[model samples]
Target chain A: MSSFFLFVLTTLTVLMLVYLYRVVRGPTAFDRVLGLNGISTKAIVLLVVIGTTFDRVDMFVDISTGYALLNLVGALAIAKFLEERGEERQ
Target chain B: MTFEFPLLVLLIMTAAGAIVVKDLISAVFILGSYSFALALVWALLGAVDVAFVEAVVGAGLATVFFLLTLFRMAEKDTQIRRPPVPWIAFVALPLLAILLLYGAGDLPAFGDPLSPASTHISPEYLENSVEQTRTPNTVTAVLMDYRALDTLVETIVIFTAGIACALILRRGT
Candidate 1:
């Protein structure tokens, strides 16, 4: 059962790497943001994996909740920055 | 050991691949994948609580937020090749990696009987953790009860990160 979870986790990581490649090599700034968003989602799952590893979930639950909040704020901030940049270009 | 070895190898390969990938968006996803792999390894090591946090933070919200940011970014020419950063930073990273790997050398085996972690608190917790806290999950008990102040402090730090991001974005205008 644990091994199955590990395999699933690995496959997800591989998928995330593909996304990261898009972020790093993609021509557009928007692509990178997309990749970053993918990474954050992966992080949440990663947190769950951690909680499972230690057999205690409350700490990780709080951390994951906090992480989600941070990720949302960060995305908004980046979007705002890019929008401002676009305006500046005009 | 068989299970652990393959996972570690996969982790190293993906990390290397993420660094070498030229596409920015792909790179971000690769980072996500790296985090996922890490979470798996964390779980196999018997740190279920940490694994849970990693899965939620590393695989879920972080990836979504990153994509949202990407959506608002301006398009650029693809012919520009890889993004540039200082070579010195790249050089320094390997040294850090080597140090981290070196630190792992002396550690106990995964799930081994004599691990310091297993020996450290299990006996005590087995005896008193449930009795004192009335919780079946010892890890949760420890976090919410035995060391709640620390957890609260950590939460505040996360809150501060949010505030900092808001200030940086808002004040720039």
Candidate 2:
């Protein structure tokens, strides 16, 4: 891997650590959920980057598609759960 | 090295955060993030199939299950107090980590062709998969042909889990 790409990956990872801080210390459930959603979206991009590094974009792209689909579903489910839980508390 | 090291650190941090978080809902969300990080690390290591499974199972299905269980618990129970410092865990876990790290130093370097994992049946599977199973992907061939029974059992296990979850949740409803 070139130094440029390595630098990019390092920067992105540091960005993810920032997101991790939000996840760990977010004051509200929604903030934590949004943090997780952001991280998963980044994961899809990271998968593509790793695919290019391995020179097997075709195979890894398929996996990333699946990952993205599932992440969307999981996020929606969590949002619905949170909405319902809020109503119950009221 | 650039790819795996940062990801491994993130993975461990998220896992520990998930455990330490006071709220079950926040912990579940962090756990999903942890799974996403773990999947990336697996992809970086070239284990695309395992990475795929981790993405779907860990980030997807497992998170849903955790949220469902969290909702089932009473709201009061969800607000758990901070656990006391685990003295035994602090001692045993570090000792285990050191021992594992010491052992890992003796293992072959990453992607070493002569490593036991790469040298044994894997090479033969890679060489013969296409011709023997008529499958283009060696991973597909190994899962479907070389270890069909194992795959079948895994499918059955997942099916049973779904059934069990349905049964339990149905009763509560």
Candidate 3:
């Protein structure tokens, strides 16, 4: 069971690396933001998967909850900033 | 341990990407990704509390603050200038890397049971922390009770730094 969790964790990490490639090579800032969001969403799951591996699901769940909230707030803030910038240009 | 290598690679890649990216917004986003990688590394190392702090402050708040500062700047200024490569960095970087590697050699291996930290004081704290502090988490008990003053001071330092940043970045009244 633990090994299965570890496998999932490794797979997620690999997927995150793929997203990171998008972040690095993406042509537009929006593409980079999308990649970042994907990475962050994966990280939240990674945290919970780590907790399960440690046999401390409750603790990690709390951290992941906070992480999710912050991730959403950060995405919203960036979106607002981009929107304002677009309005200024127009 | 097997997953650690890939996460560390991710960390290094994000850090390098952040530095090499020309667009300030892209760099900021890459920095946020760097923070996520670091937090994952901390979680892998079994430091969930540290990972939580890294995820919150490093990834969340710092990225937003960076974007806010970038938004305040002119579009032209947001494009980073390609500075000439510094000759000094060539000499200094290798020297610094060598010094750090030499210093690292003196430290105990990761998770060594007989390491100074694990051998001394840690056992007692691990045993009695819950009884003394009534906190289920030993790390929390140690930080909040055994070393309460230190944590308080650290909080004050962070608060002061936040104030300083706001003062420096404030616009005209």
Candidate 3: segments with Cα more than 4 A from true spot: B163-173
Scored by TM against the true chain B, the candidates give: 0.70, 0.89, 0.88
Candidate 3 retains true contacts at a fraction of: 0.77
Regions more than 4 Å wrong, model 1 = A1-90, B65-105, B167-173
Best-fitting candidate, scored by lDDT:
3
lDDT-based ranking: 3, 2, 1
- TM-score of model number 2, chain B: 0.89
Name the best candidate (by DockQ): 2
* Candidate 1 DockQ vs. native: 0.17
Taken over the whole model, the C-alpha lDDT of each candidate is: 0.67, 0.85, 0.89
lDDT of 3 by residue, B1-173 (tens): 47787788888989998889888888999999999999889777767778888998999989999998898888999988998999999999999999999999999998899999999999999999989999887777888899999999999999999898888878532
Worst 10 residues of 2 chain A by lDDT: A1-10
Residue B129, model 2, lDDT: 93
Candidate 2 reaches a DockQ of: 0.81
